[model samples]
Target: MPSGPNSGRVSRSSGRWRWSDATRETTDTPTAATLETERMKDRYGLEVSTSSAEARDAYVEGIDRMLSAEAGVEDCLAAAIAADPGFALPHAALARQHQLYVRPDEARASAEAAVELSHSATARERQHVEIVRLLVAGQVPQALDLIRQHVIDYPRDAFALAPACGVFGAIGFSGRIGREAELLEFLEPLATHYGDDWWFATVHAFALIETGRWDRGRQLAERALEQRPSTPHGAHTLVHALFEAGDDDEAVSFLEGWLPDSDRASVLHCHIWWHYALVLMAVSRHDDAWQAFRHNCLPGTTTSPPITVFSDSSSFMWRSELAGQPRDRAIWQQVREFYEERFPQPIVFVDAHAGLTYAVLGETEQLQACLTELQELGEAGRLPAGTTGATLGQAYGAFVDEKWSTVIDVLEPLIPQVVRIGGSRAQRDLMTNTLLAAYVRSGRTDEARAFCAQVVDRRPTRPVAGFELC
Candidate 1:
């Protein structure tokens, strides 16, 4: 019965149970928690007086309630960050929202603003920039130190330790994140304090999937939906797990039956639907998968999105691989220019790493400079989030050289870690699949078969958003 605002349909083996049957109960039971999670008002008022610590806690709690429930409230929170110009929480909220929308610069700005506005922005938010910077610099040790320090300071805050997980995952911190207590500590208490916090449960579910505890992931994801709020993090994790677990029919049922209406949801949560598209493609439904990407980034086919979203490496990779056709090279040119606008260099990884795209485009000097910059940062520890990371560097190296096997070999082992750190499952899959197809084209099928099986096995089990088999 997972049919909340974000719930996909839930089905039972027995024909005896149906959604209509579940909805037959006349009046829906309205509760305070439900009300709290559904507060979509755009008004900004500090109703909770902050003279006392209790009032501050209440104020924070009220804001958290709205943010957790309503998507539009994100703009409100961002405005609040602007309005106060000093409160740390609004900045954190704005940063997180920016991150969700795949706007890394916005996220970085918000995180930095949070630290600038408050000296006590908590060790976590401060570490955000520090770790990202170190990752960009390619100084794994220095980056880990900053993240490890946060672990000691805010041992109970998942937000604090979560960055370490990302650092270790995407950038390769010369350590195993799954074995890191810093990450476990963050996740453990989150599952405890917010046992009811579906967002935290999403993280927990991902951890479970990583550990091969599929049953646990399934259970946690179900529990997450039971506590569904406005944001679809829980739904993203839940659907991903179901798909990964080979519950394709159930995943589809979940999406169509319980899925929320997607219009005006957010222009940037492409991960949400791209995930769904991956699952659908996995189940051999190319048509459905194509529609997912089209619905996501394709412009003004209305029920179609504005085309502005498609101009990126990530988006084009999707268009190339899953559109059940060859890539539109014209689109690639447009996307390349668009990516350039978003990632003008500052010695960042995405840009430096993206130099491979420049290399592919025959901009030899740009590629060489990007390579030189990337190596320097990786060795010295100067890059920031969305910039320096071992995986990005390694992938870029092989990518620039056109060494398909190296890309696969280097990236395969890094997948679980990067996803754990929230490096983005959709992005990683795009990179991996791109490598896989290229390998096949090079007549390296024997090498790629194992990897393709892994992709087929893994992508569905860890369901992405907006995808379902037709």
Candidate 2:
């Protein structure tokens, strides 16, 4: 179905976007510096803040505003930059906005400007935004510049160090691991300081979960939820914590209630859809899971390129598998090569999950490599999700290798770990279902029975994980 002029829009001008000539509610002569600020308040209704925590909030808020199609986020970012031209992020934000809109020159200029602006930022803050700017621009070399800087100057900035945790681990990246023990040293303090801030906590959660602090990550996520109960991210983190802690039943019940009342939309909608879909998939509702995927993809079908306009698309795509479907092959082929070659350094979740769609297309090698990298990340404490790339692959490997013990042994520990370390209870459904299959197939009826009992304890309302495994 084609969207008539306003499918995903919140505001429009006679069915066309009012891009430049914005409507303003104020009459003050716009300062050249704050010209964008006046336009921002007049058009989108956002406030300016210079504090670190507020910067994080503004980032999310600006992204939200852009999602609403109110005014381009660039409007508010302009205002932010006007208020404090020294702030690296406002310029970085504009660069990102330009990159998304496909203004290459502007994007490059903005990224360059971010570097120039960073001179005034604290070593930690400069290191933080530079990689992001490079990452956003797809300039991996420049991104790597900051990576080297992270290793050398002010190496303790949590944001800069977390991604560096797996730089060498990436199959395509360059480096030899010299004393891998250092990873823990770098991540511990970062995770400790990041306990309450949502984004910091999220990054730290991944760091913790990836490094094997499943219980700790869950606790931190709980702390994150306490900080901002209504923020979608907090809700997202809470779900992962519950699911990983082996509470799938509550996870499902919680999401089922939340989705109807979620009553809001943003770039993170895909996370919601995917999370819900995972719950439905656990309950063996394939149709509902598919619907969730479709909902996340709707904007992509209607739009193009960068699909950040829909939040859940990123998470949902990474979480859901698509081997049996015909359309999935088409989706895989269309973007697989581009993502594989084009992205300088892959966003692991995106690359790993996207690569899995090719499992049946004889791209098992690609999938295997992705899974290997993910396994390394999980083992080393970089990929907090503990998402076994081939949830089925582990069981199949155990079966074919006649190591039934491996299947039961491997999956038995993983179910709770997944729930505990992963971001939300909603996300852990995939783990529970995967473990249920692996346990039963490995011919460990005793453990499977225990799993059956354990799975139900999480959510008494969910039907027991029956003998059918998956």
Candidate 3:
């Protein structure tokens, strides 16, 4: 909520004045004056208009690092801000980084600074700051509206395109019906402007996969990876393309090959490993999958946002549980500890995952605490997806209590709208799987069989054994 700024503090990156208008007199800063002699344009052919060449170079490199899942993006962004404190785009970029890192307070501060400073920025920089501000505020629908115009105006603004076109992007995560179609429609037209751009290739490939263009998506992902071997977004798209194409073996091999050097701080770091774990689960390699979870996905292993950590860890455990894999109580204990440390309050998706751990571990008090809060939030109409979450929290409690009928009653009607809570089809399947399992467990054989068939038809390539009622 920090907007239309007045000299606020931006959370420091490395004990430095991370956000300040350092010597903006132009004449006073001799070094900036000297460095400003040469000007360079951005990828969109828009002049960066920074006082320091080093800052411009660092900003571009930082963007690449972030897109590629490499380290040093923070350092580079910090350097850019230090060199040119009034650079609105870098401030905007820093805002995005802060949001990704789950420091919303810092993100808003940076975004506000970007907005205020953007008055003097070029049209491109202003656009960048505005879009980023919308993103930081979780206004995806509005951000998409702006991005639609942005693309028409500056189709080559690949940096702006990155967040808009990602698999976990505003469009993908918007929970709108026909999101796949939306992604395809939004990205397909702009493909010409971003020819061979590695980030663009990855995003377009993901859109293709979502829209059922699996072969083309895979080919594009592969080409992108070839261009930038460390491109995590490309790797992510390829994983999805392979999954959709029913090629689990290649998916496993590809992820394993990349796991060795996956940057711990990169956005895709934990998520790629999550994909690897899912592929292993698909192959029924439970032990290896658990190994991956322990090594790559345990709480402290990577710097993925809380949302990623919550989904990946909870889904792994829930999937394993559904598969009848023996529970590692120690890891569950670790997961519980991690959850407690990170989430004292639960959003809908995070709440359900927290309920999973609490139920499995018989932590009744913890589960009730989350449920109580969720119910309160739901009734107040402040929750994103309405009262379904509160109902699910109750369902989870009933599920733990072995009250299968209660679980079915709560979730059956809500199943159609499950995507509203946000998460991809694959991720939301945890809820569907739970309902199916509950039906079978409750001895409702006919209903269980019918639901199982429906699920199989929807995800025909999934391992048949996982969907079986018996």
Candidate 4:
């Protein structure tokens, strides 16, 4: 068996077997003791800290479920913690889940507990817990630095590497230029370490899709789903690749078949349904799109994380109006209430969508307040996305007022930097659609045609209403 900090050797002494961390030289070892020790390894072949088999099993289950966006992650992690309260990794994993679901206080406490417990853990496990600790504590830059180093040392530490992967990951929200490309570059080198691993394939596929390698991404996503059909992350990544490839019909068909088997309580369920609604809109199934939104993507209806609920609800509502559906103040109001209840501070991606909600509701006071905060954060260098959110907020306000020229002026320059705001390109299409609308409404027909032509070259379909006139 491969040996590392996590590896252990099993020995029989005094008519009993015990596991120890002492390194043993390989000599074509195929002893019964060696075989028994190998069974103690994790799914990725790393030896875990816990001696309890039940704790290790539960921890592995929780980590796999979390990576796949499956239901019962909390239950599994809690079971692991209950089985072995001193296990540091499960505490760190639970903290990540709490953070994702917007339970900041719980996240912090769990993270701190993990850090405290990690003093007795392996070096790899200690580093892993510390990375989660930094992330939950909002020390993202330091966390990212540690993540990069940790992955280099422990490439199979999937949970530790996860925060730096995908569109909403640390690199995705790094506010750095060419972050999409950066993510691809970061993941490409790690592929050899995780060949055909479902979770790795899903995340890597998302990175590929984001960087415009849709065909390859789609292939990888399909392979991932085949490996683990229950993975909502795999399904969601496939939806993104299909959306980018302009395969609306196929995307809708795939979702219809896949979603029935997915648990609605899963973390990515609402987001996956949001993708379904998007494809329905692209195919001009406006009524179906609205139904999908009201049932799955709405703030009140969705069981997703608060950030997912806020962003999906607000983005879908705004895009529905852009697609010629009448604006519903009631729906926007629900989203606003959810945002207020869940997010008391600015999260760049959620704040960007909240800007749309405020502007459309004619809540200038609230919109300006958000813009002011973003501007202040940007000025102080406190915002990772810097001025991107503020700029988009301005564009949303101008968009609502029908100041097409101002919308164009503000958004055109901001387009290149929009990736810093943190979301998949498809989500950011809310901005692109807004700019396209402005171009068409402002009678800049040539510019609209030119801009839209660029879009069609990439997407091959334009779902926005009035786009045909352009």
- For each candidate, what TM-score against the reference? 0.61, 0.51, 0.83, 0.91
- Runs in model 1 with CA error above 4 Å? 1-49, 52-70, 78-88, 91-182, 258-260, 263-268, 298-324, 346-369, 383-427, 442-446, 450-470
Better of 1 and 3 by lDDT: 3
lDDT of 4 by residue, 406-432 (tens): 999999988878888889999888888
Consecutive 10-residue window with the lowest summed lDDT within model 2: 1-10
lDDT, candidate 3, 86-118, per-residue tens: 788888888988988879899999999999989
When summed lDDT is taken over every stretch of 10 residues in candidate 1, the lowest stretch is 41-50
Candidate 3: which stretches are off by over 4 Å?
A: 1-39, 138-141, 439-470
**Which lDDT tens digits does candidate 1 get at residues 1-470?**
23222222211222111112122211122355654543211112112111222222322433433333334545445444443455565565566556544566877777666656556544454555455544444455676677666655444444434444422233333333444334544456544444344555656776666444657877877786675534465666667677557777777767665445643454324545665665666666767766776666433322211222432234444434433455555545555665666555543324323644554455667656666665566566555433334455456556546686777677666655544323334344555555555465456666655655655435433222222222
TM-score of 4: 0.91
Q: Rate the local accuracy (lDDT) of all candidates.
A: 0.48, 0.47, 0.72, 0.83
Provide the clashing-pair count of each candidate structure. Answer: 37, 24, 0, 0
The best candidate in terms of lDDT: 4
After TM-score superposition, the amount by which residue 19's alpha carbon in candidate 4 deviates from its true location, in angstroms, is 18
Using TM-score as the measure, name the better of candidate 2 and candidate 4: 4
